[model samples]
Target chain A: MMAVVTVAIAVQGNLFAVVVLGSIYSFLMATALVALDAVDVAMTEASVGAGISTVLLLGALHLVRGEEQKPRGRPWLPLAASVVMAGVLVYGTFGLPGFSDAGAPIHQHVVPRYLNDAVRETGVPNVVTAVLASYRGYDTLGETTVVFTAGAGVIALLRRRRRDRRDGDVR
Target chain B: MRNYLVLRVVAKIMIPFMLLYALYVQFHGDYGPGGGFQAGVIIAAAIIFYAIVFGLATARRVVPDWLVETCLAAGVLIYAGVGLVGILLGGNFLDYFVLDRDPVAGQHRGIFWVEAGVCVTVAGVMLKIFYMFAGRRREDDDA
Candidate 1:
């Protein structure tokens, strides 16, 4: 199902349909994450990817042509590079521990401590929240800063365009 | 959308529930899958839905640009303020353990404020982006 949506998005010429299809792809990906038991990730994917990005893309479509333009030339080098990167990524995954292995290095490390003592230490029933907001406070702060920066960037770009247009009118 | 009575009625009914759910997710994140980020997006989505149905100008009137901008900065301030308080309490930066008389209570307190900060900032950013895009179209139409 996800693959079908991705292929449709890739081949679609209408920008609106492509945006909608991309959101569908994100929804499917979020469902896949839930099936994999990453509920937090699924929530983020659903909200950011499916919900917000779709609106942003549709807004962008309004500012530009809806139909995607045909490529001026074939992208042989980029295709080859993508293939090589895919192959390398596939090769790299082979070195990973088996799925849900109890003795995986990751499980052996901080997992035990978090599971056994997170509630006692942070007093939060949800270990994920405890880890994110308390144990990993600095990292969460940095993530918030990044989101702030993105908002600032969008404001700069969008607001400045309006200002420039107004100045041009004055001239 | 303005002429479609059914659409407007349904949106009117749903918007409150959507906002309520966002609040539930925000405060209940400590025990569930949701957190500030998800809650923030949900809140913004509700507003955006309202804007889509009732018109952008109406939505803007409800949530003014200045308020949204304030939220964007205040959230970051709240997060950093908590960290500063921790330092003043004679602990390291962002040391939740020193937030209250009891370390466990302090942890809870710190997490609550930090999450609140995250919620505020995330909601602000999402709304800011939406306003910029929607307002741009309105300006273009005016010109």
Candidate 2:
């Protein structure tokens, strides 16, 4: 079903349908995340990917025509490049431990400590939150800063538009 | 959109709940399958839904551009300030254990503020991006 949606999105000429299909694709991916027990990620995917992004994409679509752009050159080179990249990635995953292996290197490193001592140390029942907001505080701080930068960048780009439009660079 | 009576009425009903759920996800994150990022996106989506059902102008009035920008900067500050406070309390930057007499209590305090910062920043960015894109005149309109 995911594959079918991808193909539908790929072959669809109407940009509006493509955008809607993309939302469906995100919804499907969210479900897949849930199946993997990544409920946090699933929630983010549902809200960010399938929800707000669909609205954002529609806003972008409003700026352009309903149809896909005409191809100006052969697409085989990019297709071949993508295929090669996919193969190499698949090949690279071969050395990973079998699914849920108890002795996997990742399990050995920090998993036990976080599981055994997180509540005792941080008093937060949710290890995920404890890790995100405390143990990995710096990383979350950085992420927040990145989000701030992005918002600042967008404002710099768009907020002064009406005044700048008379300069003839944009319509 | 305004004339679509069913759409307007349903969205009017749903928007408040959507905002409420976003808040729920924000505070209930530590106990549930959610956090600031998800909650913030949910919040932005609720507003964007209003922008779609109503009009961009009306939506902007409800969430003015200035307020969104303030939230954007303030969230980063709140996160960083928590780290600085940790350092000032005789621990390394972002060391939550030093935040209170009880390290566990400190951890709770640190996580709460950090998540709040993240939620505010995420909500601001999402809304700002949506507004920027939606506010642009459609390319075909003038053509």
Per TM-score, the best of the predicted structures is: 1
lDDT of 2 by residue, B19-134 (tens): 99989998988878788888888888898899888988899999999999899998999999999999999999998889899998998888888999999999999999998887
**Over the stretch B1-143, how does candidate 1's per-residue lDDT look in tens digits?**
77899999999999999999999988999999998889999999999999989998898899999999988988889999999999999999999999999999999999999999999999999999999998897787688
TM-score of 2: 0.95
TM-score of 1: 0.98
lDDT per prediction? 0.92, 0.88
Top-lDDT structure, candidate number? 1
DockQ of each: 0.85, 0.85
Clash tally for model 1: 0
C-alpha lDDT of residue A63 in model 2: 80
Residue-by-residue lDDT tens digits, candidate 2, A1-171: 999999999899999999999999999999999998989999999888888888888888878788998899989999999999999999989989998799999999888999999999988787888888877888999889998998899888886764577566555
